[model samples]
Target: MTNWLLRASAAGLYFFSAFSFAADDSHEQFKQAERIAWSGNYEAFQQAVAGLDHPLKPYVEMAFYKRHPRLRYETEIDHFLTIYEHTPLEWPVRDSWLSYLKRHNKKARFINYYRDTSDAELKCTYLTYQLDLGALKKPILEQVADLWTVGKSQPKACDRLFSMWSKAGYRTPELVWQRVTNAAQRGQTSLLDYLAKLLPKKEAYLAELYQEVRRDPSSAAGLYRFKQRSAKESEIAVYGVRRLIWRDPELALKAWQKMQAMFTFSKQQKDSVAYRFALALASKGHEEARFWLNKVPHERQDAKLLQWLMSNMLKEQDWEGIAVLFTGRDNLSHGQKYWLAYSYAKRGELDKANTLWREVAVERDYYGFLAAARVGVPIALNSEPLQVPQTLLNKVSQAPGFKRAKALYELERYTDARREWNYLTNTSSDDEKLAASVLAAELDWYDSTIFTLAQIGAWDYVDLRFPMAFKDLFIRYSERNRVDLAWSIAIARRESSFAPDARSSADAYGLMQLLPSTAAYVNNRNKVSKKRLFQPATNIRLGTNYLEYLKRKNEGNEILATASYNAGYHRIKRWLPDEAMPAELWIELIPYTETRDYVKNVMAYRQVYHTKLGRDGNILAAVLDMKIAK
Candidate 1:
């Protein structure tokens, strides 16, 4: 046994040495292939990759895949597709190519390729495309449905199924009604009724459906029908009155009293009842709408209901009510905290505002920053530079009017902060500019202040006082960073479209939407007095510098960097890792629907700027298309 063990160990060592040498050789070969591929030599690229094996082959193939549709080397599409479909390349590349095929109406090819594609997201996308392209019918629908139904409880699958069916125009009211009923059985009656109305001809059958369901009330279908019928004002009143009286006597009394006072109660009466009931309860300080809400039946809380409630809450400044609704709900992303904090602050509840701000600040939330700035509370800036939260940055950067300018200033991106201030001052009436002069003087930006005053050629727009100073230094600094000039101009365009003095609830200050901390950072870096950050040049320079930093940090991954510019680098980085290749690919794969759209816009903007400047239009494209370093 001892002798056998020794022999085995020796053989294992020899095999390991051989494997290591082979791996080294394969890696060298892969690099050679990559070099040839990059040079546009498709034949050599193909030959080099073919000579490789296993893991090395996959990477080499990926490199070639990325540079497909070679202008010079016209490889047969079939060969490319065959290799992509059968090879062990990464999913992102495979999925990208498959999507490309689908886009070009390569239906037969897509169908064949999709059969071998196992990635669920890719498969769903392909199937959805098939349905969209009109190549799919009921038979295909059934197959997709069966696959989805295997895990019906999973929300993603259900959503995909719904999306697929909806896109196919399969208006199965019965199925919608059935789902609604099922939801009701699980105490999700509200969800059930919401889905019920989505069915075509639902209103015509609603009454009969409700009567039948109410009589039986055994299945989800029955409950859905009952809720659909009960969604009416008269029905809701009857149900609400009973439920409120039993579950919440106070709210019931309020609803009953409001309903009884209505002179004409018909189809419109029900809408009025719902509206008035909510108003009356709110007026009576019945903060919790639980009792009356329960009486509303499931189906009535559709998109319409949700919109109505949210709209009212916003318009009426019902902070307490909104707080009740959103509290402990994961459905509300951190983005919602700003509005919540604003509502609380409006009510003069400092403690609540501070608490919520703290919660928001922890996540570097965008709205939270505005809320904090609005409330005039001191928020500790995260020490790490260029790591501010994206949500806050995006909100501030996108803020409209003078409020946007203010947000930039408050965030301490003095250069941009001041540009917005100057814009407001320049565009404002003489009296308004005069009021703002003191603000400019405080930041030591007298030149911007004076120039703005001079530019009020015919002050036609409303303006306010600028109390911060530092204008001269700001302009000087701005000249130092041409990129800031471009960025400031771009930001101005994006925010109020250079309307200057643009204001928004986001509290973004100036042209560049610099947060207070960012402005301060610029102030410190330039050795300009901190007070001067609000000067137009200072704000512009700082804002531009920050934007440039983002561009550099993402290695010219403009989309990621732009989102970082608008949102924040930390937030964008959080979506991906520090790895070069995956990071670039992941930026293209960002899931945040907003950021994804933002990247395209920013890249398009960059390209436009490149063209405007008479530089190569493809320069930015080359920057974007560069291979991620390993």
Candidate 2:
């Protein structure tokens, strides 16, 4: 209760500690009202907010509208919107008003209050309203056509609109056929049968044949048996080739050879089919990948294709192949340049490798550390101090969004506070952003502190970006579990941004995001009886112990332990290579996108947190040069 009511009083002092008690009490009252409002006690909420003279008064007024029976109060809703018009409050109020109108079928009022928004369901509803009012037929029909052409089914709100258009004859046979084709291409085959009923007889027969070829991609050989070919046949061939290639590239390649002789596909379709099939082979580490690679024209190579090609070469240690593949390419990234230099060194070209390493050694990333180690140069991942202006700080402290954010922060609504903070940061100047970052840090808002500082894209203010908040708790737990303090900090930052009550959709609780079952098991095993796991000290204690257990189980590999923590231990064990490899490449090959990103970020953040703790941040010694345990 104190944490909730004290934030508003504290932030008031944060901006101006010299204010009188009456001003401070009003702020505290609004904070109390916010809590009551969310508790669904309308009478108590109203009484608490009555006669409040604080910056949060607007939020208090809006809270009355929030708790009010929504559709029963249109006049009041309109009055609310008019009072808050052209402000942030107006948009949220309008969104609520629009939802009320949508529920009550108030068509004219819905359109009258509508604002341009990106919500798919809202846009669909608006279009439905336009159709209901008997507006211009051509515009409405065009939108209908656009919606019907999508591969996946839309929200249930869109079904009525689609049914109306279909019944009114706007859904022609050609249009339905086109939609069926689009559905098949995007792998939404469940939509095909319903779409087939709308097509002409001959095209409907073709749709069945398309589905057959699609269901069993290996049956693509049957496509060549047709005496005549059309655009439909061409599409089916490409679809079959794309799907079958992943299953068996050898079979797909044979089908492609026959497809070339048929001359059914256009040049662009042919290029795409060839590029996809080749990479499918390369990703599987098949030697036949080279055959398909030779067939693809240089212009057809995309970023993903090039990455898989390089990954395959690196897997085989084909250094000459890598050199031949990337020589004289001017768009190489820092990581690519380092790998290219490594390839040159592997091929016994020391002079060429050293020249490239000199440039790569200056980067502030993982490869830079590796390159620095190679060249005996100092790592360039050094922090710089922020140069903020005083005037910008003053201006930001007065911004409306900041006031709302401070208000919400006091109420323990971190999610709502973050929304206001984002609104402020989007339109802020660089110095104002720096000031906001500092303010977030002062408020113990670790997530916003980390995010806002990163938005500035300046690395010098390491202290502000990576504050060692909860130092005694984190240090005590880390030492007890025999875990590195930097690693503990990194996990805490990535897991919850140090939001002690943070939760995920998976039902994980607290800063370390431990699942309920995991927390219970840890408690039972450790003979601890703390019921509230959200407290910072207890969460850190359990999280550090769990991470340490994972580290030992993975043979002292931080990469593997972090990966297992994100993706389960059993799943990570299945991902290990046959032999030891560089942790960098090992991380890239991780199949789970979420786990892969988690590992890299935790490792990188460990370096940042280490540097913030005034330790020598050696990236090479930390991760790059070491082997990820198999």
For candidate 2, report its TM-score.
Answer: 0.81
TM-score (all chains, Cα) for each model? 0.26, 0.81
lDDT of 2: 0.75
Per-residue C-alpha lDDT of model 1 across residues 528-622, encoded as one tens digit per residue: 44345434565567766776667778876555566776667787666663445432234333545456546544443333333333344233323
Q: What ranges in model 1 sit over 4 Å off? A: 1-488, 525-534, 577-589, 627-630
Clashing pairs in 2: 384-460
lDDT of each: 0.48, 0.75
**Candidate 2's residue-wise lDDT over 446-515, tens digit each?**
7787788788786656666666768889999999999999989889888988888788898787888888
Error of 2 at 274 (Å): 3.7
Q: CA RMSD for every model?
A: 24.3, 5.5
